[model samples]
Target: MAEKIKLACIIDDDPIFVFGTKKMMQYTGFCDTFLIFKNGKEALDHLSVILIEKKPIPDIIFLDINMPVMDGWQFLEEITKIDISETLKIFLVTSSETQEDRDKAKKFSAIKNYVVKPITLESLQELLPTI
Candidate 1:
């Protein structure tokens, strides 16, 4: 069995993807605490509050590229502006197939990796070790 990590967070615009990821996390024992946000903006807003209150930030964040108000890219920028520790692992998780998106995500040093979606068993299996 894996160690009980504090929390894992999912910030995606698609409902189906969020549902799938949540079920997978529960099924896999990958995380003990899980948070789901509809878009990057909502996640950022809530996370920012947590940051200020000195609450335990998420252990990992699966961020999506496209969204209505604030996309993953914008959220990443906002996250940096906050004073959270540098050790948190953030992955750019999205369905965008473009190489440009991957390159852009890589440019942000805060992001640990870029993962394509609809994220599968193999992807999560591979990702589990890293977090």
Candidate 2:
């Protein structure tokens, strides 16, 4: 078996996507712990607290593009203000497949990959080695 990730975070408004992704992660033994947030703002707030408390930050983050409060891009921008470890890996798990979105994602070096919606066990498995 591949080594498990210490922690994984999911920031998306879609409950269905969150539930499905969690299930797949569990099935694939993706990570030992999970942090689920409804939107980018919520995630940012919680992560900011985690940072302040000197807690173990997420090993990987699955961020969505569109959300009600503070979109993924906004979160990315704000998160830069905080001192996060470089080891943290972020993946854009969005439904958008537009070239513009892809191009925008490339601007962030922190983002490791762009995954389409409905995250799968196969995709999680594929990420193991890279993580």
Candidate 3:
């Protein structure tokens, strides 16, 4: 079996997607803990405090591209400025499949991959080895 992730985060405004992704992760035994945020600003604020306090940072983050406050791109720009652990993996989980977005993601070294919306069990399973 693949090793379980110690912590995982999901930053998105959609409650349905968050709930579904959480269920999928639970079903796959993907992670031991989850930190959910409704928007990028919320995530940034909480994560900044966590980082400052030397708390357990998330091993992986599933970030959404579009949101009300502080979109994924902005979050990425800001988060990269702070000192973060090397093991941290970020996956851009969005419904957009545009080449422009894909190209833009390449600029951020922190981004491990781009995953389309409605992520399936198989896809989650595939991610286990990488983590």
- Residue pairs clashing, model 3: none
| Model 2 lDDT per residue over 23-90, tens place | 88787776658999988999999998887677888988999999998999999988877875555589
Better of 1 and 2 by lDDT: 2
Pairs clashing within candidate 1: none
**Alpha-carbon RMSD, each predicted model:** 1.5, 1.4, 1.2
Worst 10 residues of 3 by lDDT: 79-88
The candidate maximizing TM-score is: 3
lDDT of 3 by residue, 3-37 (tens): 88888899999999998889988888877589999
How well does candidate 2 match the true structure in TM-score terms? 0.92
Candidate 1, superposed: residue stretches over 4 Å from native: none
lDDT of each: 0.83, 0.86, 0.88
> Could you estimate the TM-score for every candidate?
0.91, 0.92, 0.94
Candidate with better TM-score, 1 vs 3: 3
State the number of backbone clashes in model 1: 0
Instruction: Report the lDDT tens digits of candidate 1 across residue range 1-131.
Output: 45656689999879899888888877888775788888878998899999878888888889898988998889988888887654668888887889888778777877888888879977887887877
